[model samples]
Target: MNKSQLVFVPCPGMGHLIPTIEFAKLLINHDHRFSVTVLIINSPFDATYNAYVHSLVSSPSPSFPTRLHLTLLPSTLPTNISQHHKGTFLDAFFENHKPHFREAVSNLESGPDSPPLAGFVVDMFCSPVFDVADEFGVPAFAFFPSGAAYLGFLSQFYTLMERRGVDTTAFNFKDSGMEFAFPSFLNAIPAKVFPLLVLEKGWESFSRNHARLHKKARGIIVNTFEELESHAVLSFSSNGGIPVYPVGPILSIEGPSNPAQQGFDVIKWLDDQPPSSVLFLCFGSLGYFDQVESGFLDRTAEVGIVIGWAPQAQILAHGAIGGFVSHCGWNTILESIYFGVPVATWPLTSEQQINAFHLVRELKIGVEISLDYRTGFSNGSKTEVLGAERIEKGMRDVMAAKENEIRRKVKDLSEKSRRALAEDGSSYINLGRFIDDIMNMK
Candidate 1:
């Protein structure tokens, strides 16, 4: 009857934290001999995340609340740490949580209901915590919530730079024409589409540290399915580095859409739209639109309701939604694929550029808004405004054909994704194998 409890340290960003929770829920739901405790690294920049965790802890008909525990780490940002900090400040932000995690693990060991500590599943950004995991004398995993391709970039970029003697210092973002033979992609990857932060002035060291940690973990768990990224998924096996577990399309909580609940009006609005007509353009919660200068009151809102936040999965699932104007976040990419909605790929940051490339060039399931249009906190790309023409073209191309090649592929993958998560499917079997790895850790 002994159960091994796994502690997951997910990064504070909603894009990262939400999926980690879903993965934790899956573990406890799929098997009875395992339990999960998700250590929340709260973000001072966003209270929405705070509300999210509260909802998980306080859900009325909880999914796996008995065996799943979500609690805040004691390292909530202090007065000295400014709310508007970035760059190395984030490094300090994650580093400061180490002792808090150590203390939380200590407290868990003493708790009456606590199971034997299995190990730690550290998010890609929370690599500093691998040190604490090392101290605890248990294995640690690097949870890459994005996908196999992004994981491939992090796993190999250090070698790409060092072994080739490529200079990180002199790298220029202006060389949009250059391409690299990155291992993950089917086609040669354009240099311009690589993550902006990794090439920035101060982030090289940070990127290297992350690359180093990816090697240190016993394995990397990706929120992807083998059917979706077979090339990138298979690349890990040949390299003979850290093992990878593609136990995903590990999606967010999906309950029946209710008219009375949050995001009801948006859903109700969509109820009137014709099938394969509406295009959902959501940039995730971290993104924003002030919408001040334009004459707001006179607009009919052709592109569905413009809300602060959305039940994205529900909207995408609706027959009304045909194409998604996406930031190409991995979660949204999988969701778009799951719902059979094609994407107008517009990458904002992180490895989204590579994701956009994957969608447009490799899978042909998306059209590009601006493949190399990198942006940051202040929208620091060469052209920030993204002209109306380019945006229109992206939307038009994706929505151009109802039963086109992109649509067909998306539908096929959607069906395959559903099966992959079902009993005895690829992702399902992968999840079992990952769990077996944990149980064997004992």
Candidate 2:
């Protein structure tokens, strides 16, 4: 009676690693028959990342049924790879790590006393591992850490580009607002809200390779609940080639609270604020507050609590947090929604632009700072610097009583998000279905 083993390969970033780890915990908790081995690609720049992954295993919780094991592979790229490609290092890094990844999987499979190999679960960035999974006669699942709408857009964009023969990189949106039809959306997606990958250089080849690899996967998993993105989830699930499962808002109920911050000064500051009176602004890992113009900071400080960094999940869950000024990363969007905090959408890079659109337009849970704002991707496009006035106005709009309806809507959705992860909810059922599908794989 050996337990089944599922190998997970997550891209070398906190954003990808967090959700993938949570998903693994979900699988093991849902049923005791599965164990997860996460293969993490060593980060040359961040020496602490591997240590963080190891901590998850070392610090086991009594609540979870099983512990996750982690293995750190050697750095696949030279130390100076970032100096070469600059912003496009992720695209090149994943492509270069194929050999290292394949060898690691082979070694794991050949080890004596190994549990029966159930399948391979890979981050969307590591889709190249599909071939390795096929070699071992196991199913490979693509885990998308973002919303279903972004996944739907990725799946449909390449086909649309081919059909229209439009070079997205060459298209200019100086004065006119260009719109394109997507099956996932009832209305057309404006050029301003298109993913930054389409606008960035050197991403065309990477995106094409990603799309091809995704199509080869046996199934796709997204970090969104069906109630949140019904249309987009249906679009991905109906593809017929690869089955798609919506099994998320897969956040840790315990939350990622920093132990050191228990009695910290920031906690005192938050305690002093009135309930639902503060606004929390957090971008993802690479995000920085210093990149913002000085004038914008001066004005925002007058309106809200401006801290360098806080425990985001804890802050969002706080009674003092009324609104969020976010870069609209999918994780942040989900967290804010979970806490019933409306957002002032200011998308920075990657699929955030599309997520911003969904937050503001579709979900009606967020207000927009600017749809045309682009930064952090190094796409040769001039970075849009928002002035103090615009920033203040956006903040005012999000926190004002006029936005009470939006707040009420998000509060309702937050309850639904929680229920979706409960025993008989949509996400819970989908996760069980996915696990059963893996067990049935022959």
- All models, RMSD in angstroms: 2.7, 3.1
Supply candidate 2's per-residue lDDT for 289. 51
Give lDDT: candidate 2, residue 69.
Answer: 75
Evaluate all candidate structures by whole-model CA lDDT and list the values in order: 0.80, 0.77
- Candidate 1 worst ten-residue window by lDDT: 255-264
Candidate 2 lDDT over residue span 352-425, tens digit each: 88888888887778888866576745533454578888889888989988348888899888999999999999
lDDT of 1 at 155: 70
Off by over 4 Å in 1: 58-61, 76-85, 169-171, 174-176, 253-264, 292-304, 378-383
How high is each candidate's TM-score?
Answer: 0.92, 0.89
> On a 0 to 100 scale, what is the lDDT of residue 351 in model 2?
81
Top-TM-score structure, candidate number? 1
Clash counts per candidate, in order, are 0, 0
Q: Give the TM-score of candidate 1.
A: 0.92
lDDT string, candidate 1, 57-122, tens digits: 556354455777877766555346554346567777777788899998888889997788889999
lDDT of 1: 0.80
